[model samples]
Target: MTPQQYHVIALSSLGGAVAAGISDNDLGAISGYSLLSDNATLHAALWYPGSTSAIDLGTLGGVNSAVEWPNHALGEVVGISQTSQIDPLKEQWSCSYPAGSGFLPYTGQECRGFVSRFNRMRQLGTLGGNNSFATGSNIFGEVVGWAETSKRDPTCVAPQVLGFEAVRWGLEGDAHALPPLGQDPASAATAINDVGSVVGISGLCQNAVGALSAEHIVLWKDGIPHQLPTLGGSAWNTPMMLNDEGAVVGFSDRPGDNNGNNFNGHAFLWTSRNGTTDLGTLAGDAVSYAYSINNRNQIVGQSCTPGCASSRAFLYQHGTMYDLNTLLDSSSAGYSLIFANDISDEGTITGLAVSGAGSILAFRLVPNGGWSGSTMGASREGRSLPFRLRAGSFGRIMPNLTH
Candidate 1:
């Protein structure tokens, strides 16, 4: 009998568009950004199946773009990018930040969500404001994220002026706002299922970035806000993704975090029948985050030490979370799976894995023969210090995509 093993396909990221997300079984197609050769620009990028190089999706007349979420739809990729227009408000919105570098001095340029197809990018317009950000989309060609309005928000801190709300865009780029839970001033639609059920966070306007704005985890069904059961605390209750079966997965802070934004939490799974269950962290770890889940209930995320300072990629299945580094074939000696971002329904996992030398890159774990990742690896792991924090999602403005 042929033995079960993982074929680790390391992805290349040196240079590149539109940002996008959700998991379709597109071989090893990945969505992210790369620092251009000039070292001053960040452009959205895509890695086609079995390709070692990156395909850069140029910006909409601006210098920066990123595909933040993992879109499962192969034909469509949606994300945020900057345009040539300068912001009249002179504000540093969420788009002012990039992944690797710190804040880019509030370029004062307007940013908008974009959809990419066949290597071409089309900008998605904002709702009476200068900025919009796309988080993720389902197979139905529906995009979900945040968009701004014309009115200036009083609750918003300095540097964030226009009021923003959660948004859902159709295939034709028509978008409408999603109401926040109760009287909460702002919200974001992080993920959606094929059936139109959307999951996200609803809270005060805060800084118009993330984190504080995600104080309440909410699921919208048929346009009504149904706040999901929580993992006790309220600060970072973010619903990163949900499967077609209505299973929602993400991170939720416990009661102990002194600073509200500090991500002292555990990965959580919420279902209709079972309610919310805390998926414990890796052995000796202080936190965990479930980024994506498949129809089979397999979950992927990172196990971290306090606010995700140090982390390792993890695959959670059958009531256990295992460090992905332990499952690699012998040739993966120098690689350490630091962030398991998405897992396809077929059990293929993709994420950023840092090397021993500290160069981080993308990787795919494909199950061969008769074995699948759902039933692989025991969770026995000693504390590992090989991985560090993921590059900040928006420079110092925000560290994570949703939160």
Candidate 2:
């Protein structure tokens, strides 16, 4: 099961390499972040098909903003951005992007979910709290993510003073709390399809971030939360994305995983009909995550070695997992696709690539003569690395959170 030859386009970054995602529509617009000239701030940027110029999606006020999920809405982009208001609670909510990541830190500023359309980015208010994150949005302009409630949940770990819950922002940008699983204190919605179904996590409010905040992976249909099956063990059950057809994909811990203390899980595909199927790591790789799944059933994400210390991008199709690097056109033989971020329904893929000399860059792979695209190639980087898969990336994507 080999993929068709694909030419690569290395999307221009601000000053250095960054992560990116391709839109799920035919336009192929791309959303990613960039290091500004000051090198102290990062802003979300958008790229039109075949264009090298990056349009910086201005921030709300604070220094950082990023688009992690491949938003599916046409003419709309949803993501997390720090606002000028300082968080009274002084918590580093999920909006925080740790240092060393191309983006700047959240700096304890209040953050919010932002919807960008018609050249304006409007902040989505929280549920009576200082922070809210926007991860998914549908064509109807409804957004999904998580927002903090005023409650100082005892369930939260230190520095995480408030309780949070999955949120669905209405067309008018109103935030509505989505119920968590039975007695759960936290939840975060990662993706929403055009049909309005959502997939996310429901669990203990450990840090207002993902780690302890993700327990029971959930699917919301008609606003009712349904617990999605796990890969045996509990903890780390995260639903990163869902397709219009109700297919969900993400990573989860396997049985005997010490309750996710050991992130010993593999990528999984879940459908109402088939339950849950672990996509298993790339041969010896011990960790895998399926970040995006298209209606066509193609899945893309990263697989990492034990401890997730090393990584490689992978494409799973037809019941087989293949390292994306092996399916590239000759022109891109010099680079290794390190993180498979998103795959459009048309089969176009966007992710990060590294050269032999340690240079990293964002890339988009377009199938030969299949649709709109352009290419930039580098000579084989001192001979391709041996064909093998174990672990995968520098960014360490955690679904919607840059953390």
Candidate 3:
């Protein structure tokens, strides 16, 4: 398939929207966040295949909502939406803001994981706490993510004494707390396969921000947690997405002292056959992350230099990670494709793209030719690196649209 010109999604009239995740199937749904005309509040949005205007998934009564990960099938999406209740503790629960610019800042409020059905948002209750986040769902309608618990823990950093646990939610909103490795105070299940296997992080409750500085990558099979090895670092051992075949991909620190930051790790793929394989960064770039993995094991994320000031989107397949900028058409100058979030089985990618003048818009790239080597290659890194990081949504922000 030859690469075709990418299409920009139309989410807002003011043009500050970003697409964070896409469904795993070919021509799957697209989800993200966008500001209303006044830009006072944000809303989780879903777009049907080939549609430009987004369907606003209203909040659970609060002013903001975000879709981070949608199911590979239709009529299913998992994300965080705020409720009408105000946060009495004034805590900054980690999953509040998103990556990149052109979005509102974090305003902490009571939020929870939600599943939208027939145009209504249903809250997935926490393990006695007030906040929960749903990151991914399987075809069976089971959801996997993290949720706050009732008890306060001593290991927590300031302002975040409550503990959280990786959980699996059934179709009926029943919460099943996935076991953590040892006595770690927090765990977060980021992705689940169709067979009910889960993948996420197990770590100390450093700041109640879920699994930051995660001690180990954990995979749950039949409700048992198995520890996965890292790249020899102590933090940022994250597992982002899982394919149906049980292969998982994410980012991990490579024996560095980046203080457990996700921005300091290299993208990695894990399978039973090969274990964890490090997907190296673009030429001269220091960091990379794999946020979404399709059924074919094609991975998409971002690679950036130190501090993540300048980054480029990358697609990894067949042992090579290619910078997505080189794959763009010659007519599409003045645009830096940064932070590719998801890739469908058909090789359709969605993420944020910034123009030369610094305007941010959501873009989609469709493969005109199959997964053969396209224009993206290692030789194209010499172009001026103008990419700058805009703080984007936390966890997985996916959108769902229903008529």
| Highest TM-score against the true fold, candidate | 2
| Backbone steric clashes in candidate 3, count | 22
Go through the candidates in order and give the clash count of each. 17, 9, 22
The candidate 1 region of ten consecutive residues with least summed lDDT is: 394-403
Computed on alpha carbons, the lDDT of every model, listed in order, comes to 0.72, 0.75, 0.70
lDDT of 2 by residue, 1-403 (tens): 4456677787777663444543445568777666565545667877777876778888898778877677877888888788888888888777663323212355778888898886478889888888888888777888999999988899987778899999999988878888898989788898999999989999998866555577798998898999999887677788888888999998887877786666677899998899999999776677788888988999998887765556778889899888776667777666777777788888888876766554555678887853222532221211122221112122254222222
Clashes of 2: 9
Worst 10 residues of 3 by lDDT: 394-403
Q: What is the lDDT of residue 11 in candidate 1?
A: 67
Residues 60-135 of candidate 1 have per-residue lDDT tens digits of 8877777766676667777788889988887677666322333222456888888998979998877798988888
Ranking by TM-score: 2, 1, 3
Off by over 4 Å in 2: 17-19, 22-24, 97-104, 369-403
lDDT (Cα) of model 1: 0.72
Better of 2 and 3 by TM-score: 2
Best by lDDT: 2
